[model samples]
Target chain A: MAQLVLSNVYKRYDDGPKGLFRKRKVHDYAVNNLSFTCEDGEFIGILGPSGCGKSTTLRMIAGLEEITEGDMYIGDIRINELPPKDRNIGLAFEDYALYPPLSVYENLAFNMRAKKIPEDKIQEAVSYVAPLLKVDDLLDMKPPALSGGQKQRVNIARAIVRRPGLLLLDEPLSHLDGKMRQTLRQEIKRMHHEIKCTTIIVTHDQMEAMSLADRIVIMKDGVLQQMGTPLEVYDDPANEFVAGFIGEPPMNLLPATIVGAGDGFEFAFEGSPLRVAVPEKYNPVVENNMQVTLGVRPVDVLIQPGTEGSGAVPVAVYENLGDERRISVRIGDTLLNTTTAEDVSYHHGQIVRLSFHAERTHLFDPKTGNRIRSNVEWR
Target chain B: MAKIELDGVTKRYGKNTALDNVSLTVEDNEFLVLFGPAGAGKTTLLKTIAGVEFPQKGLVKIGGEIVNHVEPMHRNVSMVFENYALYPHMSVYDNIASPMRSKLYKKDEAYIRETVERVTKMMKIDHLWERKPSQLSNGQRQRVAIGRCLVREPNVFLMDEPLAHLDAKLRHFMRSELKEMQSSFNTTTIYVTHDYMEAMSLADRIAVLNHGKIEQLGTSQEMYYTPCNEFVATLFGEPEINLFPAEVVAENGRLYLSALGQEGLPLEEDVCQALVHREDRSYDVGIRGNDVRFSFEHRPGWMAGTVYANEPIGNKVIMTVDVEGTHIRLVAPNDTRAGLDQPVYLSLNMKNAILFDSVDKSYVIRSDAQRFTQTAAAAGR
Candidate 1:
């Protein structure tokens, strides 16, 4: 396995012309000035929503799309003009692009056969990777007879049969149902453990990226948003978008104002009586009456049941989601949600105390949508 | 406003059966969700209730009156299909207003304008009022379709995968929005979706269907804690529950259940007595990921295993451990870090586990069966 690198990679699409004058060439950059490095044997995930340049970045790395301007490298060798076939990379996409008429074994062996490998070596390679993905028992069956999950397994098996230096997957689990998707996700993780090839996965699902990747590269509108470990992004988001995008149910971003409460400052919500003391780490970073957005995940919001005078808010809605409970309280027009593992039940109008964890709370600039880092250096 | 009931309903197309002997009752103004996989007859059941598809062998009743032969238009039920099915030529304003302007439910222009604006704003599609269906995004079109349905005072609302087209984040946001508005519905609703999260979050009651049959119909608590069968148990939780065959052994005076090559897994007194009285010596044990506890360091009464995989989802981590020959999965903290083939120890929380009869693959008992049996039995399960 070898490390992969991209320096100032850019992909521009010339839409060409507009408004009765076809003279000007309108250049649309799908990926702009993207640069990152994947160390040897490391697993990296490219994460973003649809049309956010994630797929375009993956295609550029695979040599499927031409780079408008940049340098690409695998280890120390530059590979900008290299053909897709010449690059030692394996690809598996959302669709199971298997040969319908070919048996599972033949479909896996087809790639090696085209490379002019000997028959015995081809059999050896196919046998080694087949059981890794649990497709060994279906070797004789054609692609038409397999289920969607089974077909995807075979597709992954075929990609890894040749054991290329790098493995690339694009939304590989998007087609399966929930249970089947979980099973395949675990299998893919196991396969990665067994074969430590440098891997890159492109997906819009944050769960998939967080579970599988050692580090994640987030993008938005052809611009790189942030790149870090899953926990790093979760614990301290670089911006409001990353904070909102990285979690399930997303994070609650409410507009608030910094007001003086004795010696310190408190975040006061608009049209509501809720006031939270600003965390001590941000003391030197803020001023009184500053407009900002307060970010807190549902899991960090704690609910306390009590009588009046203890700061209670009526529950707007309570959802029993099997293993956990999701409670929502309205703050003016916005509904702030909190997730808890407690088995307590609350009705629509029940009053409860809501509090946020001081250490886990975040602040973002409302105008720029950027995070406001603390003045104190924290790990 | 209305109660929905189906008695032994069966619908067939040629040799294929879409719904078979299905019986269900949805209380007045209740939000009942029909949840299952593809081709599980969820949509078919909804259609039968909407009078779009007639049952060949049974009766359909609304508000205790038999409506088996009623026409779709006369049923007074608003239905939203998987596809938007909006008027391509009209703007969003007119599409939402058309429902109020129908001959059977016609209203004055002033009332129509007021109701249309109110519904569109609630659906967050007010800005797209002048945009045609073709110019809207998939999410926008779906909102318009739902807005049209919400504008009328129908007895029942039938929605089929209304949030299926939106992306994950938008779907999540809209689900909460839908649930918040459900309290104001004050109308009987039958919603169909294959997503378990939505089914658990929104449904006052969930009907689990498989192969054109209702497997179980109950509250989310009953479906999670007291599932009727192994199939229903596997449908609720993420990472899925771990099911393995376990053998019961009675030593001296105490009984212990053994599996995964480890013997003497001490059971609680109630659980031990429940299994000892049974005639079967072998049964299936299902442990959810959260019920299985693991430690990197060996602890007393814990079984030794090898770390097979560690997947850290955003909120939590699902760690798979290899105990003997069987792979056991458990939930871990998000910051959990482990290397491949590392030694790990696991201990299952038997109190919360569900036991299934090995012969029929049906739930026998759980140690904490009383937690849900009271409510489930009261619901006439």
Candidate 2:
């Protein structure tokens, strides 16, 4: 096991010269100054959209890519100049690049053979790890004969046969179908526990990161957005991007302006008369007539039958989605989506009262897209 | 818009049977989703409907007209490829307007420009009209492809994973937009994808395919609540439905389902009556992760187990429990937490439990248990 730490890491690529006598210009940073630490035996996920430099960060840690600047430490030793072979990292990518000519057992032992480990020790290691990964019965089968899930299992087994200190998986479940992906996800969690190896997984799927990683590092355009436990990040996101990115159906980010109501502040919808009061705790930082973005998850929106007051909005689209019913209402040109239980039915064009859970609602500074926090204790 | 009908459609490429005796119907203006895993003939079926591939057997009909022998250009169906097949040299405006300018539907310049403008505005690509295909992003290119299809008043729209290449957030946004577009245009569409979420939210009905056969076809609710086989049940949910082999044991005068080495779970009166006369005793018990309840304390009907892994997803937590040798996943609240190997009690909501024939993997008894329970309660009241 190893504790990995990255401090102010940077990666930059230079564009080639276009014309004669013209110097090559340095492009934008592929990975900006990013810093984080993964404790020993802790599983962390690097999550981002494409082109966010998540893969670049992983390559740097694996010693595949040279860091442009800053220090990376494994335990107490800095490994800036170490070769990839010396990093002691196991890697499994989306493609299960297994040797088709060899049996599962041979595939698991290939790395040990390359490292010149004794046959007896290799046999011992394979015997111990194969059963843990539930591949004992599959040792004699070739990769070509195995199912997609089985091939992935053998691939992971091969990576761990060397007993590396760190395990890095890059979108391992991206190619599997939905059912197989769920099954393999559980197996990965179980394997981590049994092996107790420090692991880092890179994936664009938020659900995969939330279910498997102990902590998640969200990135965008080479910049670190937020790093926290899934619960912490989900319950209280750092900004509008994180809020909208973390949840399914995404969060509804409606433009609104803060207005004075009674003794507190309220958010008035930009294009409509709908208004929701800001929680008392946030009233200190919010001001009247301040333009802000109101963020609310679909699950937090309350929809009631019939028009009760000015808060009612007419439904534009209503869909029956198995266990839940999704209702979309058009507020000006923007459509706000809300989810309810399947039993709760609302016809399209029906008037429905909408309310927000004040505690669950979020307010953001529209200019910077950052959450508006009070000076007091606000997480 | 035209209704599409396929009767006993079968397609084969040498030794491989791409589609075998598949039959389905898409109603006029209905959004029908063809969903399955790779190698499930989803794309081939779409091509068959578009007259790109002729089935070896059976009939393809569009608006009561047989289209198996019709040329692809004369089918009046606009097909969108997974890869946005756009002309690199032409500007976005010309690419969208080309469909309206085709010889089959050539119109006056005023009519062509009006149609192109309406579709470009609807697809949110009005500002990118001057850019070529190479200058647009993947999402923008996809919108343009859809716009080309929408520009012409096509009878049927065939989309083969048009949004597969977009990022996750963009894909989610595009799904809702596609559904809204379908409804507003009132075009009969046959969309194809392997993503379950897209099938669930976007489709008026989904036809689940496996090995070129139609496993099941119904509305999303009907498919989720009353799946006819193991294949259909497994394709629908996250955390996947837990299925375990069990046996019905007649104890005294009651029938119980014994599974995972746990004490027998007494079957409901209606379920017991339904299964009492069957000679085969073995069955496959199906339960959704959301329906399985977990508690710290043991109750009479609860099965004792050990928590193997507790995974906290955003809205809910999925806990995998080991009962004897079998592992079953159950969904819990977001705040729920448990240590590995911690003792827990598991209770299944029998009302939602389904049973299947263990050997052939066919549904022996659908979940009429909920209906039976509700009816019994109403009578008692």
Candidate 3:
């Protein structure tokens, strides 16, 4: 195992012959001045939506794409100029890319054999990784005979068979369905624990990143937005984009303005008769009549009766999603979702007091889309 | 609006059977979802109803009329495929207006403009009126396709995984949007999806298909609470349901479930009654992840196990424990953490478990079947 370091990394592509005169050339930076370190045996996830340069960052690390600028090092050795095969990085992509006619065992051994490793050593490596991925029994079967989940397992097993210093997974579970995806996700976590290689995965699925990675790097529009543990990003999002992008139902981001209500100020939702008292800790950063965005997750919104003096919004949508009940209340043109596990059923148009947890509530700059920092810290 | 009925429909191509002897009725204005895995013939069932594919063995009826020989263009049914089948050359406005311009449903330019704008605004794509399909994102394109379908006055709307291509956040947002729009649909609908969450949230009643057969058809509550068999139960929940073989032991006029080397786990009165009439002693106990309780501390009557895996999803943590040889997964709070191979204790809520005949994997009994029926009845409304 080895620590990986990237310093001031930038990947830019030439946007050529596109100007009105067709003479000006411009460069579009897919990855903009990114720097991060993965400690030995650490698992990091590069998470973002499409065109966010997450895949570009991963490919640069794997040496598949050349670094447009900056330095990359694996342990104490700089690897920016090294070829892909010499980088000792394992890759498992969404496509299995396994040899169709080759058996699982043969597929695992194919790379090792191509490298001219001893026959006995090749067998030993294949034997160790096959059981870790739970593909021991399927080793004898050809790739065409395996199921999607089984093929993914073998695909990952083949990547780890060589005991590379770093493992890179690119949307490894996207092609799978729900049940199979969950099953394979757990297996990947367990496999990471067993192997403990410095691993980085690129995925658009927040749940996959939250579950598998020790730390997550959130990106957007070819820039790093935030880097933290899953809980850190979830509970204390640094911006409106991070807040809305992290959760399942997503955080409710409503445009509001700060207004004075006696001693303490309150946030008045735009175009709606809804107001929530601002937490005391945020008073230093916020002012009355200042436009802001109020952010709160569905789980942080509480619905109680007989508290209409507080913000009371009529339920516009109520859905029973088996394990949880999702209640959405209309605020102007958009709806704010509130999720609960209580057995109570709510009807549409029913007036209910919706209170935000003071500690869990978030305020953002409406213009900049950045979090308004305060002294509040989640315990 | 019309009611659709498929009676003993069986479709085959050479040696492969896409749909078996299937019979279903989608009431007028009711939303019915067809849910299963990839090859479970959910798409085949939807295609059969839209008159795209004809079944050789049975009849497809729309508004009490047999449509076995009907051409798809004349059926007055709008279909949204998994892939957004949008016109690449046309702009978003023209693509949505294409349906209204068809000969069967042609309308004047004034009405077409009004209807196109209304559906586009509702679908949150009103600003993309001038962009071609190639310029839109996958999510945007899918919404445009659905908007085109929504602009028509079809007797039935058939959608196959409309939200499958969207990202997690957008998919979640659109699931709510679809549920909100369903009430105003006022048309019979048959939706197909491989995602359980989409099916559970959108369907008034879900039909679980497996290997060209309908395993069960009921409300989401019924499907979740009292699934007909083990396969159906596994399909509805995350972490999959924990199914382990257990033997019914009778002692001192009381029954117990012995599983995973843990003995003397008392069975409830209702379960005992159901088990007394069954001829088989062996059964597969099915328990959902949330029904199992766990702790790092060893409490009374809790079985000991080793931590197999701990995954922290957004709101909750799914912790797996290896008890003896079986791995049981449970839902823990988000803050819970445990090291690998750490000692843990678990106790099953047997009252909430469903038992199946071990040999055939068919439903034997559940202690609280009455509660499922009540909730399902309420949900159906």
Q: What are the per-residue Cα lDDT tens digits for candidate 1 across B1-381?
A: 798889999999889999999988999888898998899999889989889898898999998989999998988899988777899999999999998888988999999989988887777678888999999866578778878888897889999998888777777766776787676666788999988889988887899999999999888888888889999998898767889999989998898889887788777788887877788989898888888988999898889999887888777788989888788988888889999789999998887878899989998888867868576556443
TM-score of 1: 0.91
**TM-score against truth, every candidate:** 0.91, 0.88, 0.90
How many backbone collisions does model 3 have?
A: 0
- Cα lDDT of candidate 1 equals 0.87
Better of 1 and 2 by DockQ: 1
Model 3: DockQ against the native? 0.55
lDDT string for model 2 (A155-237, tens) is 88888888899999989998887667877887888889888899999999998999899999999988899999998889889
For the record, the alpha-carbon RMSD of candidate 2 to the native fold, in angstroms, is: 4.7
Clashing pairs in 2: none
Model 2 interface CAPRI class: medium
Off by over 4 Å in 2: A13-28, A83-88, A93-107, A110-116, A140-148, B83-98, B109-151, B249-254, B367-381
lDDT per residue, candidate 3, A1-379, as tens digits?
A: 9999989998877754565776422236888889999999999999998899999999999988899889999999999999999999899999999999899999999999998999999999989999899999998999999999999999999999999999999999999977789889988988899999999999998988998999999999778899999988988898998998887778889888899944599888767888788888887777879998889889999887544586877777788776788988878656788888787688767888988888888889989999987754532
Predictions' DockQ, in order: 0.60, 0.51, 0.55
B337: Cα error in model 3, Å: 1.1
Off by over 4 Å in 1: A15-27, A307-311, B81-98, B108-152, B375-381
Candidate 2 or 1, higher lDDT: 1
